[model samples]
Target chain A: METRDALLEAGAALLREQPVGAVLTQVKAQPVAQRAGRTIGAFYHHWSSQEAYHRDLLAYVLDPQRLLSTAAAADTVLADLPRGLPLEEVVRRAARRNFEIVRANPYVPLILALWGKQAQDERVRELLRAHYRSVTDRLVPVYRTLFDAYGLTMRPPYTVEMFAATLTALVEGLTVRAAVEPEVVPLDLPHAGDLSAAPGAGAAGAAPWDLFSATVVGILRAMTMPADPA
Target chain B: METRDALLEAGAALLREQPVGAVLTQVKAQPVAQRAGRTIGAFYHHWSSQEAYHRDLLAYVLDPQRLLSTAAAADTVLADLPRGLPLEEVVRRAARRNFEIVRANPYVPLILALWGKQAQDERVRELLRAHYRSVTDRLVPVYRTLFDAYGLTMRPPYTVEMFAATLTALVEGLTVRAAVEPEVVPLDLPHAGDLSAAPGAGAAGAAPWDLFSATVVGILRAMTMPADPA
Candidate 1:
């Protein structure tokens, strides 16, 4: 690997463990160099100062393509699902997938730390803005595909933009809930079509729904109507 | 006010100005005492140590009553609106009120700071958990009232708990969006029921909807149906 790539990769690994407040303090020259199997001379060869290094590190961390890969992967997974699945089942799978992706993501804690820095740093805020826009861009197509696949269109006064933003925010918000109050937002969501645990759901049985899927399905049902055939 | 109250209030004021990473460093005994107009001895008399003081501060800062007051007020405002307004209008008002309340709230920044501390501090996590519970508890009744007042009930496969949690998360998520990407999540949401700016909305004209209210109103409409009279 190139010297800069090795050093940055090492720095990224170091940052993954640091607390929100210690992001800067954790990224020192010697340790990152040692971890990268590079020298201090190599570090300075690529960057002029710690500030410059930190700026590049932030960019590397917040790069839209890197940050949004999981979400993109989700779209591919959902699109490839069996064609006959019920819409609610499809939404359930999507929500559960979303919850799992966020829970398993290694970058979440670090991304959150960067979010904390946004209030004090203009550059961080700009990077975050670009990141959110890309997020919206990525989600818009996923939502559009679901609507098209199901022959649905948005209800009056609600647009694809609003739908995308809401889903993104809902996921972001629930992830925070999961972190601090796991009971409130359970991690083990029932499979999309499972209903055996639902109370009084009858002999076929209804699986008790979770907050994430329940909300997503509800939004999907409420926001769309059958597309016009004419 | 009592010396403890005085000190805590002062400390809160001080902490509000500090960035998320600097929360701990900003809360010093001398400065807090000076701000509270109390002697250093008085500060010690109230608290055994800085750690003890910080514990109390976290509790004070996370107090459900103070944090939830704005949400509770939104409920009162919604309930007090004229009895005969259209449901969409009513929902629009509620969404707009929620957006305004969160945008104008003084404690939001500090609360977010504390949230950043949760990964490292068990106490902060516990406090946040308690805070989220109180938030849910507080929101449940407000949602119930909205449902009852409108003679609406949740549609099949949905429940009040999911609604409350989604709304709370949506607000929290959108608030973060507003902070980082204000344009995408537009703070200047149109007034509820005003459709003057809506594209091709015709003679009555429709106002351009914002991300927050559109998602909210969509959820409200999607998740609810007319109550059965039987």
Candidate 2:
């Protein structure tokens, strides 16, 4: 890899472990240089200041490849499931897989931290827009596939994009809540209703219908209808 | 008001205007003391350090009265509607009022900023938990009122608390997204479907159905069912 790529990858690896608010100050040139197997001179040779380096680093982290990997993993979970699963099952599997994927990804906190940073940094704001655009692009197809398999279509006035955006926001929002109040947003509670029954009609049984999954199932059912057999 | 109350309120007012991430360092002793019209010694008399003052500030802002006010406003929007409105209308009105209330509030940024700060500050985390509890307490009654008016009830496994939490997260998450990318998460668009029609049946016309409202409508519809007339 090129020196720039090496530095960014190293910086991201370092950032993965650090908490969100205090990331930029920790991005020292010498340490990043050492991690990249380059010198301080090389760091400045590429970027003039820490601000400039941080900008490039934001762009680097927002790379579509890194951003879409988690989505892709979630998609695989859905795809691997057997055909003809009930609507509730489909949503539950997707939500649980998504929760697990997001929880496990170290970059999630860093990315969430940047949500506030965008207010002060226009460049960071621009990078985030691009990141979200890519995220939406990747997610739209996944929704399309899921809806297709489930024999559903976007409710009128609601596009796949709308569904995708809501799901994204819910996952991010719940993750923030869960971090602070784990008891409130448990990842998997005993399924509140019968495992075989549809939502809004759960009987006492065991399944993974926590807040995240329950909400996702609700959104999915609300935003879709059976495809017309025209 | 007491000196401490005055100081905390002044700090909160100041924080309301600033953007989210760069909040803490801006919480200096001198300015807060000046704004509160007290001596810097008074600031020290109340709190030994800036960090201590900020902790108090978080607690002050998290006061249930201030936090629940927005929820109250949204509830009023629902209550003001005529009896027996369609479910979509109810959800849309509630969602639009919430979007407006949240968009207009000055303290949203500061509150959102605390989300990322929770990782490092145990007290902030505790304060947030308390704030959420109060928010849920306020919202449950609102949901019950809406559901009662509509003759709906929580689906077997879904409770009022889950709905309230999801709605709160959606607003916060979308606000963060809107701050960075307003175009994607618009507040109001020309209603895509007919004013009289339910969702999944939009004709190019006028109404308020943006991403936030649309998502809320979906969640509401999915999470509730018709009450049996026993």
Candidate 3:
């Protein structure tokens, strides 16, 4: 790998374990350079300062393309659902796929660590804001397609934008909860066939991922179903 | 006022502006004592160490009784809903009340600031966990009452516990979002009478709190409705 790529890779790996602030202060340039098998000079050669390196790191980790690529498999899974599948089933599949994506890509800890810095760092805040907007823009259409598939209209007082926003917030929020309160927010995915027959069964024993998926799908269904005209 | 109480008050006020870690190192005990108009001796007289002071501050701010008392007015608003009110209306009222409570007693920033310390501080983590449990415990029965009033059974595959958990997660998640992304997660509470006629009115220009309240009510209604057998 190129020297710059190596440093980026090393920084990303280190950040996953320790926060950027801690890494910058405690480890400094030697450890990251050593981890990359490059000298401290090489580290400074590519980046002007620690803050600059952090900016690039934030950009690299949160790059829209990288996130979309990581999520591509899940997108494919959602796209391949049978046309005749119930909307609920489609939503369930989507939620499961999303949970699986988060589990495999495990970025919550890094994000939470960075979030603390957001209060002081404009670049960090901007990067996160852009990432959020990008994710929502990509997913809103997917949600619209699912709603269209069932001929279900979201009840008045709600819109596709609102749905996307709430869904994103829920997923992100739950991800944070799972990180800090793992017992409260498990990530295990359960067999779909078992959901209706034993709802509380999973509550007692299902992994956090399973509960998360179920909750997301349930909220989607609840949010999109046409309101009854009493 | 007692010296200890004055110090706690001073610490709480400082924390609202800066994190505990920063305050401990950057300003130290003298600043806090100065802020409280007490001498450094008085600061030590009440507390042995910075960590000890932090614990007391956490206890002081997150005192369950204080939280409950602050929330009592909102609870009364929810409890007094007319029996004849529609389930949807009841949910809307409840959402509005919850939002109002959060708005009246803003704590998301404090909670988020404290959350970063949880990994190292067992007491902080335990305090948060207990707070979550207390809030959930207090709200679950109220949800049951709302469900009963409507003669609506939460479909299988969903339990009161799950409902409470998901609802709490969504509210807390959105609250955080509103704090960080005010433009994205508006908290405007629309005039209840204008919802149907002015669905897009809020979108066009309602305050963020209104939008937040509507989103929460909509999610609650969606989550609690009986499942369709189709």
Candidate 1 chain A: worst-modelled 10 consecutive residues by lDDT: A10-19
TM-score, candidate 1, chain B alone: 0.75
Worst window of 10 by summed lDDT in candidate 1 chain B = B10-19
**Candidate 2 stretches greater than 4 Å from native:** A1-23, A30-42, A81-84, A189-206, B1-23, B34-42, B74-78, B81-84, B186-206
Candidate 3 lands at a TM-score of: 0.68
User: Judged by lDDT relative to the true structure, which candidate is superior, 2 or 3?
Assistant: 2
Residue-by-residue lDDT tens digits, candidate 1, A42-146:
667766776676666666656776654447446754675556665666666667677677655545545555665576678888998888888888778777887
Q: After superposition, how far is residue A23 of candidate 2 from its true place, in Å?
A: 5.5
Ranking by lDDT: 2, 1, 3
Which residue pairs overlap in candidate 2's backbone?
A156-B200, A191-A207, A193-A203, A194-A203, B193-B202, B193-B203
Interface RMSD of each: 16.1, 16.0, 16.5
After best superposition, candidate 1 residue A136: deviation in angstroms? 1.8
lDDT per residue as tens, model 3, B1-230: 44323322332232222222431122245545655555667666766886666455565545565464226534754666665554445555566566556644434444554555565568877887777667667777777776766665665445665566666666666654554566666544343322453345334433333554565454454345543434
Point to the candidate with the largest lDDT: 2
Q: Enumerate the candidates' DockQ scores in order.
A: 0.14, 0.15, 0.09
- Give the winner by TM-score: 1 or 3: 1
Clashes of each: 11, 6, 19
When just chain B is superposed on the true chain B, each candidate scores a TM-score of 0.75, 0.76, 0.67
Predicted complex 3: CAPRI docking category:
incorrect
